[model samples]
Target: MKKIYYSLLLTLCVGVSGFSYALQDAKNIMESVKYRDQGVDRYSDVDLIQTMSDGFVRSRSLKMYEKEFGEERKGLLYFTEPSNTAGTGLLMYSYAEVDNKEDDQWLYLPALRKVKRIATNSKEGPFLGTDFSFADIERMRIADYVYTLKEEKENISIIEAKTENGLENPRTGYSQRIVHVDTDKNIIIKDEIFRQGRLIKVFEVVQLEKVNGFWTVVEAKMDNLVEGGSTRLIRKNTQYNQKLKDGLFNQRTLRKGLD
Candidate 1:
């Protein structure tokens, strides 16, 4: 009887330890994803001009309209908004700044010829008519998700995360996502999106390369399985901490620059 009791206690202790480790691993993976997903590495008060190559190609159908298959729209994409596009042009202006817990963004539209102020609450809108939701673009805060370490082996970590308020609407979107992370560089390799209890999309970071000792992505792709559409963005002419002028992000400055 004494031996049996000791065995049960040992098993229980091991289980508890395993659970705690899982939780910590999950949190770490989520933090890693959040860090790389946003342009956080770029210090505040610097402006960046990224030439974009964007393509709206669908294998099935996305919108309520009509589509058979094999349709795509290619254009230049540019933006400063965290969750939306402020403007798009051959020459675009973007100002990035981090204040407190949130990052602020501003875009100077060459067409409207005005500087647009993107509010924090408005980050949920669709970006530039893309199938990708605006919420999909923002940096995922560590506080928003509950993490669980699913597995770790071969120098790689897999974390399963369920975030509160993850689904912004009643569209039956994702409340959880599983992220595959590279332990060596703390970079996110892939993410599986879930809606309710089903998988709906897969987001992948591609063309991972280091520039000037900074880990950066040359291409990022998101595919919507339910909608049968995908968005691909390619980045070029990327530079960090260019020491942009303070007045560039302002409305008056936007107008003056164009003038």
Candidate 2:
């Protein structure tokens, strides 16, 4: 069996991205965020710092790479720091909203010596004992939720969306997400996730940069409201269009890791 004790040390999320457009309805704004141009290929060194409710802290390092194939986006990550967590990797493939396709994900746990596919129905679980869930890491489906333009506050557009089937949907446990989008850049700068009318998680961008003409998230934080802890994802040496090889995104890479 896989190492249950180390499962929390074996995973991570990719970039949360978006683009620019004229102000319109909620769907239009979200569409812009979902379809933003990231880049042809990219790479970065990432740090995941977690602060527990009891005041303990843990930090992990990762090598992250992303690339675009037509309209689909693929990303790969390899954990490289903290001896016990090294060699852990995650691979993801996200598609356009128009295709109505489900994004795919796989996690390689070094202890298990196997790459496990993340099922669509199990995306709600937390990542690396952090506040961010697998669903938060995956590409957001425009069809899965119905959005409404709640209000406009200065440069931020406050919008809310509810899962189509609500509580009955096994695909995601969170029934609602209230997103704060940058009105000018058309990107999600913050998000508050809710379950059964209770606020449980909050994600906010700590820093951003225009790298190689592409908007990139330099740092972000996910706070677990219910759990009283937080995770800060800090990106360093972020670069766009590295012409990353196709070999980096497959399951084989997950097992071998990014060298």
Candidate 3:
């Protein structure tokens, strides 16, 4: 009887220890994804296609430049297509999860001849009528959530992250998210965002490839489950370690247009 009792206790301890390890491992995995290497800088031409539920489609084209400075990242998108949105651009500054700093975003509209800053409270809205939100482009902060390993496949790990900050409305606007990570590459292959216990948005990778030795998402899509629309981003001519000038990432470039 004593031997059986000791064995049961030992099993219980192992189970608890395993669960703790899983939680810690999930956190480490997410951190790695957030800080993946993509060289010092990257440049790409992107096509944004939006498909409405009624079957109508709209498209735009932009030149994207992103660079890393220390632990922070900065990006600039200069719209060059459709003539209407030509010369329009967005400048973003992103920080690491440990800092928990709110990202800065500025949108330049040539028609208005003005540069508008995205308020911290207004990061939940869509990005220029596309399915991807401004916060989505800025990326989510990992410090505000707790991650749990839900499942592990051959090369994928499903992690469920719950917000513990307890804000009624967080910057990202989603309360919880299920991230499907490619364990081998430490890349987020898909993201399922939830709000109020319902799935409202999904981001999926349509194409994944190694460009110039960097794991890149050649194409991706964001689907709005509630509104019945989706947006796809296709990257063309992606080049890494471009030695892009710092001047290209500033508000002046956004105003004057990318050279």
Estimate the TM-score of every prediction: 0.65, 0.87, 0.94
The candidates, ranked best first by TM-score, are: 3, 2, 1
Q: What lDDT score is found at residue 24 in candidate 3?
A: 98
lDDT for each candidate structure: 0.53, 0.83, 0.89
At residue 195, what lDDT does model 3 achieve? 88
Question: Candidate 2 versus the native: TM-score?
Answer: 0.87
In model 1, the runs with Cα more than 4 Å from the true position are 36-124, 164-173, 245-259
* Model 1 C-alpha lDDT per residue in residues 54-170, reported as the tens digit of each score: 433322111111111111111112433442333332112221223224433344565677656556565445455554554565445565467888888886788887866556333
Off by over 4 Å in 3: 1-9, 165-169
Return the candidate ranking by lDDT, descending. 3, 2, 1
For model 3, name the residue pairs that clash: none
What residue pairs are clashing in model 2? none
- Candidate 1 worst ten-residue window by lDDT: 60-69
lDDT by residue for model 3 (1-259), tens: 9999999999999999999999999999998898888899999999999999898999999999999988888999989999988888999998765676778999999989999999987888999889999888885577868899999999999999988864424677888889999988889989998888889999999999999999999899999999998999999999999898877888888888755
Candidate 2 residue lDDT tens string, 1-259: 3685456445321111111122237888898888777778889999999999998999999998888888788988888989988998989999875787889999999999999999988888886666778878777777777787788889898988887666624566788899999967778999998898889889999998988787788999999999898999999998987888888789998987666
